[model samples]
Target: MNRVLRAALFALVVAYLIAPLLVVAGVSLNERQVLFFPPQGLSLRWYGAAFTDPSWYRPAINSLLVATFAALIAVSIALPLSYVVWRYRVRYAKAVMAMGLAPFALPPVITALGALALWIVLQSYGRPYTVVLSHGAFLTTLPLATLTVGLQNLNPQLVEAARTMGATGSAVFRTIVFPFVRPYLIAGFVFAFVLSLNEYIIAYMTVGFTFETLPVKIFASLRYGYSPVMAAISVLFFAFAVVVFAAVGRLGDLPRLLGADETD
Candidate 1:
């Protein structure tokens, strides 16, 4: 009875989370040109429209570019930074990390305004590359934390064993430390990529229509009016997100990175 009750509760929670996606997907396939779940009659017109429209495809490409580049830069920086902090236990590392996490602690609107102000002062407004860097700055905190957790989880004796074998610092990290933290390194990259992909406020304020992205386009579309095409785009967004997450989990223990004790 307890197992059944637990399972029932889990199902309810999952359903609550997934219900909106299901509705969007259902409406995307609706034969009628309006949003409806269970969707009148099924059709594929909107899916075709999602692919062929320039407005849809352009922003899709831009988002892909931004998310890819932002994740790469953020993770590359975080891996080394995380290692340095963990290895040296530097006097000011905690203060530095606290500052890195400040953007996340504040409301996103505040961060968006900050990014806008930064771009303006630097004369980089409306540039996609600047937006990418801005996102990297904003989202670095998570990957840093993930790397820290990964490093902390490593058995200290392993490092000592490598050192006793006359291994140099780089060699010790390359052979001993990296393998243990590999999962979290990958996990951090995945988290950074997904968050950057879905994020809107910074992109909206910093770049706007100049280098429009999928989220920005979605906001524009919804601002104008909702349609079956928007539903189709939403469904595609759901699909891409699912793919990113599934592929990443194949490379690492996602739940563990997310604070789960169990590796599985």
Candidate 2:
């Protein structure tokens, strides 16, 4: 009876969480321009528009580019920071790690505002690259945390053996450390990429009207009034998120990457 009750509660919770997305998906199927539920009739035209329409397509491409570059930048920053802290136990490592995480710890608006100010001061505001930099800095924490976890799970004996075999520091890292943590690296990159793709505040604040990510574009489209295209885009994004996460789960121990124990 207890197990049945728990299952029932779980189903209810899932339904509550997914209800809005289901509604959006249903609305995306509407043939009319108006946002309507039960969708007057089934149509995939909006989906086609989401991909082919310049307004949606261009911003989406920009978002992908920014996300890719931002994820790379985040991983570049996190890999060394995590490695030094884990491998060398550097002094003030915790403080340094905290700093890496500070951007994410603060409110997004605060970070966005700060990025805006900095860019303006440097007279670099409204540049396309500014959003990329802002997102990379803001999303560094994901990779930092994931890499740290991977480093923690690494066997010290493996390093020692490599060193005993006359492996140089770079060689050890290249051959062993990297391979061991590669999955975590990929996980971190994906985490940052997905978040960056969906991010609006920092991108908007940094580039304003000069650059538009998909999230920024979606919000911008709202000013013109409602359209089924937005709903179609939402469904596309949802499908994308599902596919990416599913791939990540298959490629890595998703639970452990999320801080679950090996035993769990």
Candidate 3:
């Protein structure tokens, strides 16, 4: 593409992705209680409300708690799983990985229904922890995929050298394997964290009328009336997500993380 054409295309794509967020942020500053594009007047009232109101605070806390626990669980499970798949390459490795990622592949509504049924069978209703578990189930796949790519790029010679130096299996892994994969692990953790934070459908279905997360709270507010507070929350969430991904990009090779050929 020519320089001008390429620049125009890129700008269009950026606007397409950013327009909704910009609108939400703009509406959040409106002095009016109701949501409107091209906000009637500018004020920080909604942002203040989100910060001070218990109604918003509680759900925000819930979201943070769930996202933190889910990210931890996802990383814990994915580390070993990725290692096994990369090192052993067992006969059913692909099948096992696919099954682990099944929740993400199916329609989200189907996953929500399945989780609800499973929760009912397990008799764990009205539990916020169940929502965390469900989020972990889906988010683990992203970390696993990221770690797998990192492992694939790793040179086996490093491990073999450690072994030749009389290093034990665990020692070799700690000294060599772990360091090489650290960047990927960080990337995976951030990915899982963000996914768990923003996820809504599963949280909505599985929690039912019991517990509420940030997204659920925002969604409920929208039903009653649009408020600038929702926009404030959106702005916060967007800022957080951007910071996380930017940190990941800085820590690791962004192009490689996105499946580009780093060799070129």
Q: How high is each candidate's TM-score?
A: 0.92, 0.96, 0.95
Candidate 1 residue-wise lDDT, 46-128, digit = tens:
88987898888889889889988998888877887878778887888767777766877899999999999998999999988
Q: Rank the candidates by TM-score, best first.
A: 2, 3, 1
lDDT of 3 by residue, 58-114 (tens): 888888899889988988988988898877758887787887777778998998888
Per-residue error for 6 in candidate 2, Å, reads 1.5
Across 147-192, the per-residue lDDT of candidate 2 in tens digits comes to 9889989999999999999999999999999999999999999999
lDDT of 1 at 167: 97
Worst 10 residues of 3 by lDDT: 255-264
Cα RMSD to the true fold for all candidates = 1.9, 1.4, 1.4
**lDDT of the candidates, in the order given:** 0.85, 0.91, 0.86
Q: How many clashes show up in model 3?
A: 0
| Superposition TM-score, candidate 3 onto the true structure | 0.95
Cα RMSD of predicted structure 3: 1.4
Candidate 3, lDDT over the whole model: 0.86
What's the true lDDT of residue 142 in model 3? 83
Looking at model 1, residue 125 earns an lDDT score of 95
**TM-score, candidate number 1:** 0.92
